[model samples]
Target chain A: MGGDLGPRATVEGTARALQSQSRLSACVFGPRALLAAEVDALPADLRVAAERLTLCDAPRVIDQAMKPSQALRAPRDSSLAMMLASIADGQADAGVSAGNTGALMALARRALGTVAGIPRPAISTAVPTRAGGRCYLLDLGANVEASADRLVDFALMGAVMARRVDGLVAPRVALLNIGVEGTKGSASVREADALLREFAGLDYRGFIEGDGIYSGQVDVVVCDGFVGNAVLKASEGLARMLMERVQATFEAHWSSRLVGLLARPALRRLKRELDPVRYNGASLLGLNGIVVKSHGGADAAGFGCAVGRAMQEVDQALPRHLARELDYWRRANASVACGRGVSGADPRRMDADNPQR
Target chain B: MGGDLGPRATVEGTARALQSQSRLSACVFGPRALLAAEVDALPADLRVAAERLTLCDAPRVIDQAMKPSQALRAPRDSSLAMMLASIADGQADAGVSAGNTGALMALARRALGTVAGIPRPAISTAVPTRAGGRCYLLDLGANVEASADRLVDFALMGAVMARRVDGLVAPRVALLNIGVEGTKGSASVREADALLREFAGLDYRGFIEGDGIYSGQVDVVVCDGFVGNAVLKASEGLARMLMERVQATFEAHWSSRLVGLLARPALRRLKRELDPVRYNGASLLGLNGIVVKSHGGADAAGFGCAVGRAMQEVDQALPRHLARELDYWRRANASVACGRGVSGADPRRMDADNPQR
Candidate 1:
């Protein structure tokens, strides 16, 4: 409801999700009249599927301009707040939004709290790779300056998400750095690298450069919010630019345009395979409840993907899995520390985030 | 000589450059016999132009696995060192390398030294934009954690390069951050934003996210090496993936294969437009002598592009322009600081890298 496209895309996307996922019921929180009208304006089949969708009145909207603190101080009647509240109140198994990220993150953290041993929930999303698989990138905008231990936390959380949400038995986790050399990156990354080398419950790959993100070499790439955000956005920009260039090339000549028509199916499949809309859903990982954040400018298909992502998390019980895996790590770390006298094979000490002792 | 693809690409690329630029002469520094073999292997047309190319025997090799400090400690007979020495000895106006980035930057800064008011050289390159224009991105991996002042210095250098090399009236310079808001980035970026707003040298467009880089709205984007490196590599990765995906799409089905043949010209043009080889050259800015770094894995065409970029920098005297523009800003800053009683403007103070007062 608080997205850039108003209620049109969300309502239409909700109808689409309901149509596709038969058991999925949506509680759309927005201005009831506006949502109802948008729902009525949908196509016949989708409109009929709207019977599974209910609307709640949330007149207030948190826009992109509002700061996180300012958003918290504002009225609780905002759509972002109400949606998270619905999750906390147990009326919804999961929630999704395309609102101001800072506002949504802050509100969701407050409403749902965080998982055990996790102070802040990080944002995680799967990016399309060259192998037709997905590589998960985390801390997209949660903590701007994650410490070395926080990076370890991100690796753990991201590995958990990749394993459960994406059905990977043992996800390959790597820290994002400028270079692959041991001495190439920031101090925190180096420290995290040393820790992850031994703190393994999963396959801990070494440092990965940004170019390797799409190479499909690693399953999960962990970084601070700043680096993650920059990489994701820049990748999106480059993808869009390439897609446009492809289209413009087809439109250059009449013969080429005719060829484009013949190749429409292949081109269309290429576009679909590489579309950002299909990957619009970003999971706010390490939260007590399931929440997915869609791109604000996403179309109906994109928003529907976010809804689908939320449903997947709900079905997988992602948060519970994260907690269980994290607890196992804590116990493993504790035993290792006790056995090794806190100096040998005790990688937990390398993490400043060791639950703050 | 230190790149992933040995001297083959470098020697062939030099021949190609010599063939294209009638006046361009190069002193190839590798094993003389090896380079001679590669030179003799070129096409007859290119071999004839290879008359202007001279081969200097550099028997020592510094592989990518070596650290920067270790590279310096190693024998100076390496091809990388000889290339810089040629430039320093006034035999060459510029130098290009596809060696290890850390080694290259370290060696170049040591050999060429830095411009006045700048302590280090930043890696700068032009990325293709949506509008068929190029946007300069700097500090690609030179300084991983650039301070606020370093970011400002990058902005100035990038703006000068854009103005002279690209010949824009006034480059729209921007600070790369996660979000555009004043409160949305790291402390250094925020401080640089305040500084750039009042610095009064170039047209500072304030903050730009990684996604906005390709929008063609700005001519220059400045960021720390870590963020810049991540965004750049991710972009290159994405572009490569997209190109491969397009090719795979064409080869998908039999009917599509016919369409691909029909659309070969258009598809070729699109591939040519988006190829990473076209943007291979990365200029090492702020150095006293011109140096361009090609991709380590670049093909002959890519390495030739790097040589071409070096020639362009030499022709335009990019380093001199940067020094002059930076001096202008310094004088402007000094006058404003005096007139405003040090509180009015004084963006220089905002930059902790202000030559230590």
Candidate 2:
């Protein structure tokens, strides 16, 4: 009832995901009647797998167009909020939804709160690269007005996620700016550059331009939400237009159409490799729980990818590892973290003297 | 002497351009000895046509890495400065350089000044679209921190360029923002949208996102320099990456390689259609004289396109038309123009009592 495809896509995606991960289980949150029909339609193998799933009866739906504030006031019986509540109450290991991004972020923040030293969570996802690889890009639209301090925190959390989630020991982290030159970006970006350089456990690679987003030279790219959202959407729009043009050109004349038939396999491979749906899941990094946001318009396979991502995070104990890492960094760098004009200064730095962090 | 390929590419491109435009002539600015050698190697027809060429002996060259401020202090004996001076003195109808962008913009502004009501000129160019067409995009790197009023000025200037240069009457104009939603971008974008709406002569289409730049949905896209530069470079980088990947995939397998052989003609057509060099010239808009900046690394064919663009602008009397239009807009909407706090506020509106524009 939450996504564009409603509960059907979510339930079917869950069934598909269950085939890959035997240990995983789900608590489906949607209107009970609709959820049951979707579940009943699952194949025999998945029907047996459905024995592991719990259907939490949530009748009301949160529409995609609802503003975050308006969605926040939605009945607790709504699927999205209830799904998040399950994670908050420790009844579920992780939560995944294909709901509206802003409303989802707002609800996730209110339900789960921030991890220690993180003022807010950032929306992050992996972007495919020409090198036949991918890089983690963060703050996609979470914090529109991210402070220098928040950017530094994103670098720390993003690096941790890359190391834990992507299996890299030292991820090459970069701050996204208008130009690669040191003098190119806003004051906050320059300051974030300085702050990242001071972090000992992180591998900060200075600045990367918008074009460098897909260069595959770095593992993690960080920026304020405004720039990130613009780059991601713009890249998607351009890629779609180029592909459409190529298809049109290939079909224009009989000669080209003959060649197009020959090139079909290679073209299909290219399309699959660059499909945005393959990288549909956006992690709400810096949150206290494991949460993944699927694209609202994503199909079953795309939403399954998001579900698979959530399953992976739960297996890795991502939130626990992140909390431990944040506590360790603040304790190690308490002196340098103090006296900065930066907002959302590390709480763990203050608590370091108390020995509770 | 200026671009990456030095005097050879510039000289050769000029020779090629001379072949197409019978009425055209050139004043070559470089080391007299090196310049003569290149010209001497031109085709027989072009050599005789050299009678129309003037070789100015400027011994110094501005390096691509030179800072704009440093380049400003470069000797008057340098090729870049000399070329611009030739335009300023009306010896050349327009100037084209495959030199450093920052340096070119700085010198163009200093030598030609802004048009009557424009505070600063914007760096603008046409980007190819899937519609088998191109649209103008501006402030590629000119004004990084544009105010709302400056944005309004950009809209006016961009519209004039689309109309006069692109030959479109009432060219649809839009302000590039993070989102199309009226509340998405910073305060300046919203205000610029409002200002654009009041201009009856212009076809204001409202806001477009970064992805819309190449959508061919609007005739002109205006943005602050930072976002514009990032988007332009990012698009270039992605296009290059995708093309490289396609080539790699085609060559990776025997089946694909065989298909690639059959697809060669179609592929070549696609490459030619998307070639960045074909759209290489970037106009320095809102300036009193026509100044075109070619890619510093452009080769003969690419530089030739820039030369062709400059020639087109000259034939059309672009700057004169822009000045006339700006004067008319301010005079026609004197009351509304006065009450606006937008920067580059129409000075003509302040002088409404004066008879002359």
Candidate 3:
């Protein structure tokens, strides 16, 4: 009903996730017959836990090519829209999808709305870094353009997520820019930098270059969705290309082939460690409810990871925590200039009533 | 005398480049005493060819922290200004530096103005891709924001570079965007896509996502400087991180340690294949003269690659070839719609007289 692999992968992944999170339950929203068939095919152990599964029939499917406007116009019975609607209606604590990103964002925005002080929800995911640590990068493909205030909001939300989820007391935050220098980047980024510095609660580390994303220097990297999306995909492309080359090189010469055989176990471990599947779940942050976007092309294991991510956010009550923190920031903004040297911020934009300004 | 490592790396790299390209000659611009010492310390063979090297004694250096405007306002006698002046004055065919990018771009643009059809110069360099090929990415950090027509100019310039330097007859060109769908990118990129399609000579391949940059699916990837710079640096950072992880994995356990020793040769070979140093030089394209920007942190061997890159472009007559192709495009535009359905391009902007329109 969702993603490229549709209900088959989704159902299997849910079953896989259930094995680990025993307390978890799901209302599978898709074609009733399809869900029923997949549910029937679940192993005996999972079938015994069938009482936890609810097949919420959603006959219509949103095609990958569907535009956000088109998706919004789609029937309420559509799987993606229905899944989001469940979250809105208080029937579901969280929703996860591997559907079209634009459509998901549009529907999610319409259904869940935003937490106070947040102009829009952003796509955020943890990127593995060189130091064997993780850096949370946001606005992967949500809002293409972000204002300075919006960027500040993203920083706050990201920091909250990192602190709460990643267990960091004061997670270091940085704005993604062309260079680390204050002089580099677009006017919006420069403005964001100023505002981030003023964000009273954030542990703002200023700017981080594209390469610095993986340098493990910061915990959260904020960017407008355009740059964030580009960086994420480009990095994935490079890693895939490099892995292919590594494999090819191992098989190139007979002498090397011998070494490749000896290194096979270690290489497998290395590949697993760097596997994109392990990092599959991308949280649509800043929303009033938790929604994880699994990679559409992901298999069961990858989708399972996405489910696991959602479970963690739900268990930790991510939305409520984010809402409370955002409220605190908004209230604090009236009296104090958040921090020192808050540059380039429009006073009109900083006004609480016009968050999008 | 510039860059992080200063004169020694430059002197050594130049010497290394000179050995490979026997016809190559250079003017070392820096403090006379320091240049003389480094040049004097060159290997015996390179020293024997000292007659070919000219040490231009410029007393001042442009610090890395200097802003572009600051560098521009600096005395014409400074080392950077002197080096670029040499290229402009016909004393040098090309200029190479590992100094400040913004400073270099400003100085390079001032010294060598833009070609007739190009509105501004773009920084382009080859990024190693998966299919054992190189993808030329442009506007690395030149124009933070580019118009639709300017993006078309980048494609033409990039295609010309690929054809002349890489010897590709018709390089497959693509605009870097968030999504492959025509509807996915910013307004500028969409317009560029339309304009690129109209350019009859280009093997225009529409849009490619970030991951596609390393997918080897396209020969040239075009973007505004901001995104391009971020992508380049992010990829470099990611590659470095992955390499480190691979090394650590090999050392994690006793059994893996034994395999690591046996597989050292293959790993070294892998490292060389994906070496960032091998792809060190970035050409300031669209400028009237050749200017290569080497990575500031690069060592002697890495700097040598940048010199080698500059030599290749010089030998291939890159600027001349680019001028001819651009001229061909301009002429063709008058008679034909470059291709079909060119969208969002300002007709006035396409005019040579209104380059900034």
Per-residue lDDT of model 2, residues B230-275, tens digit only = 6777687788777786777677789989988877777778888888
Over 4 Å off in model 2, which ranges? A2-4, A40-53, A327-336, A340-357, B40-51, B331-336, B339-357
Number of the top DockQ candidate: 1
Candidate 3 docks at the CAPRI level of medium
TM-score ranking from best to worst? Answer: 1, 3, 2
**Cα lDDT of model 3 by residue, A142-175, tens digit:** 8888888778778888988898888899999999
Q: What is the TM-score of chain B in candidate 1?
A: 0.92
Q: Number of clashes in every candidate structure?
A: 0, 3, 8
* Native-to-model Cα distance after best TM-score fit, residue A81 in candidate 2, in Å: 1.5
DockQ of each: 0.79, 0.57, 0.72
Better candidate by lDDT, 2 or 3? 3
Candidates sorted by DockQ, descending order? 1, 3, 2
Better of 2 and 3 by DockQ: 3
Worst lDDT 10-window in candidate 3 chain B: B348-357
Query: lDDT at B127 for candidate 1?
Result: 93
Q: Each candidate's iRMS in angstroms?
A: 0.9, 1.7, 1.1
Q: Give per-residue lDDT, candidate 2, residue B219.
A: 81
